[model samples]
Target: MSDLGALFYYLGIEVRQGKEALTLDQSTYASKLLEQSSMAECKPCVTPMEERLKLTKASTAAKIDATLYRSIVGGLRYLVHTRPDIAFAVGYVSRFMEDPRENH
Candidate 1:
């Protein structure tokens, strides 16, 4: 072990330690996530999803391209490993796996 106070960088997680406390950040990972999701240029919202947003099956749900939806869900799931903050939002959207609506 190095004597540099446990500075660790692994799998996009950066851990820095100091005399007072430890800090965790993933700006790099966040950037990559945005890029992978094709949202790098998208505007930032106060929250990933609106609080009142309620998703439900549409009566006339348009068919979705499963491959695309699954790809998006997979990428979001990876972010959840470290970004628990977005877990709920990601999981909420993923629930559509049974029947994804094109409008979504």
Candidate 2:
């Protein structure tokens, strides 16, 4: 596509124009996502997920709503558009959407 000339915004992502290059941000999208998932009060973290931690389908933890879990995971996937760092974590969680437990 030809230069769209400073993509002001698209799909909840804010684009900032600068001399060197353009920057994409998704704070607003993230906030609304958190609020929708009732996690607005959750703390920010450099590492969104634990390292070396393993999730399994045999957990005895209580089961969570499959629909809600899928919705949240889908949002997380969308967030990867700007925050690629969380792609691994999001993908990890997505593995359990079909039968997500609290521990997942």
Against the true structure, whose TM-score is highest? 2
Q: 1-104 in candidate 1: lDDT tens per residue?
A: 65755569977778888899887778787887678667899998768789888777763667777777777887778778777888989999888877777765
lDDT value for candidate 2?
Answer: 0.90
Clashing residue pairs in candidate 1 are: none
Writing each residue's lDDT as its tens digit, candidate 2 over 14-93 gives: 99989998899999999988998999999999998888999999899999888988988998899999998999999999
Q: Which ten residues in a row have the lowest lDDT in candidate 2?
A: 1-10
Per-prediction TM-score? 0.70, 0.87
Best by lDDT: 2
Residue runs of model 2 more than 4 Å from their true location after superposition: 1-6
